[model samples]
Target: MYAPTPESTGSSVDDRPAVERLRHGDRDALTELYQRHGASVYWNAYGVLRSRPDAEEMTADAFLTLWTRRREVQLYGVSVLPWLIVTVKNLSRNRLRANQRRTADSLDAADPPSARASAEELAALDEAMALVREVVDRLPAVDQEIFRLCLVEELTYKEAAAALGLKHGSVRNRLSRMRTRLQSELGPRS
Candidate 1:
């Protein structure tokens, strides 16, 4: 169910006006544009880049490029959405290529984890993970999504809330309840 969710439904109301000004060369258009598209743009970049730091940088770069080339770029009657999508995609690809080049040049793959752990250690880890998954599966669909985003994808508390269209405090409260339920099911592990 989470895999089928729509990331962006459409443009915002304020964005429409700002995009109009941007099309006409208004300098303040940049602010409006940022307000409208910032989150969506960052999410798109994050999907492709996978690194939070890089996704942030790429989103900024994509907007900066639009601002810098405002004169040269003509919106005509086109919606700003496609232009932004194309720009973010290209920038992400370029960043990915640059990263690949750097990694190739360095040839530095880090050392593997220690291999001395006993079979029981591995089993405990796997069992704990399975227990966590079972607890998550027992949650409602929306709560499952929030839990997955926070725990599996490692999104920040706020970021997971935004991605799932929930309030930050709501996310926290749901997570709290989820943890309590999971702990109850896990029982005392002494």
Candidate 2:
């Protein structure tokens, strides 16, 4: 996933007047704004959702609701990015609910690893995790650094940025893309 570059704007990037026009059924303005910020919205959705299809769907749903509620919605501020992020979060929650409805799901129990798991099972799980680490280490050096800083050290993006000499946004975008690539390489779960 590509990170959005800062756009050159004399006024605030998300001017209130621009938002008012969009809220008043200005289709062209809506289209323009969507084009300008779609990538950021997608990345925000991807951060929460961790699925391309889910992120895409959440992005679509967010904009659709923005369009649908145009007249009724109030644009209170200039930071449309925050609004879009909040909207995507809400949509992701909805998507998660729908997904939960389809699957037998729970967050209650913490079953220990199988008590009867043999030495073979422990060895296999260890081998699988080691293989995952090897694959991670084989990635581009920047990816390896980002994974280590975030996962191994549990650094927030800002901290990772300072440690690795990368922008926080770049760290976020790289991690998002890395998760998708890893999921694809791993194939479907049993």
Candidate 3:
């Protein structure tokens, strides 16, 4: 269900004019854009974040970013929907990562690591990690870079592609294959 707005006529609308107005500092244009796309943007953020408050906040942030960076905003095929979706996704991911870090810090502070792991347990963990490292190191240089950029750095595929000067599909496919290879290599042995 969507909120009833005068602009929400359930018909495809071109975003170029609104974007141009936004570029020229028209607040009404920004409002029109929001009325047109706010629900979709909020839902996209909610799909990623699963928290209503966070989704709402992210939606607002995405629009704010759109307004602030209007001069630099790029449109794909006369539509701002793609850019808005990507913004919401990135913002939601950042919020989730931040929340995770805060939760981890609080847990660490609350539960000091006074209890030490046994030497055997530590050795096993080290050996498992070393095996993983070896598996990763065996990948091709490009795959390794993909792994580092996508998994370790937590960048979206598009961001990774831009950083590496590769196509989005190439980065996505390589990462998929890399994940499968890693899983197969690290899975329990018969």
Candidate with the greatest lDDT versus the true structure: 3
How many residue pairs clash (N, CA or C atoms closer than 3 angstroms) in each of the candidate models, in the order given? 0, 0, 0
User: Tens digit of lDDT per residue, candidate 2, span 35-92?
Assistant: 7667778888888878999899778756765665566555556656666667777666
Identify the superior model by lDDT, candidate 2 or candidate 3.
Answer: 3
- List candidate 2 segments past 4 Å from native: 1-4, 8-11, 105-190
For candidate 3, the clash count comes to 0
Question: What digit string (tens of lDDT, one per residue) describes model 1 on residues 1-190?
Answer: 4432222423434355666576677878887677667777888899999999989977876686676556555453434656666677666765676577667755875445664567999899899999888878878866776676576545567765544445899989998998889889998687
Q: What is the lDDT of residue 148 in candidate 2?
A: 66
Error in Å for residue 57 of model 2? 1.1
**Per-prediction TM-score:** 0.47, 0.48, 0.55
lDDT (C-alpha, whole model) for all candidates: 0.69, 0.69, 0.79
Which numbered prediction scores highest in TM-score against the true structure?
Answer: 3
Model 2: how far residue 95 lies from native, Å: 0.6
Model 1, which residues run further than 4 Å from truth? 1-9, 12-17, 23-25, 76-78, 108-190
Candidate 2, run of 10 with poorest lDDT: 2-11
* Displacement of the residue 32 alpha carbon in candidate 1, Å: 1.0
Worst 10 residues of 1 by lDDT: 3-12
Candidate 3: residue 158 lDDT (0-100): 84
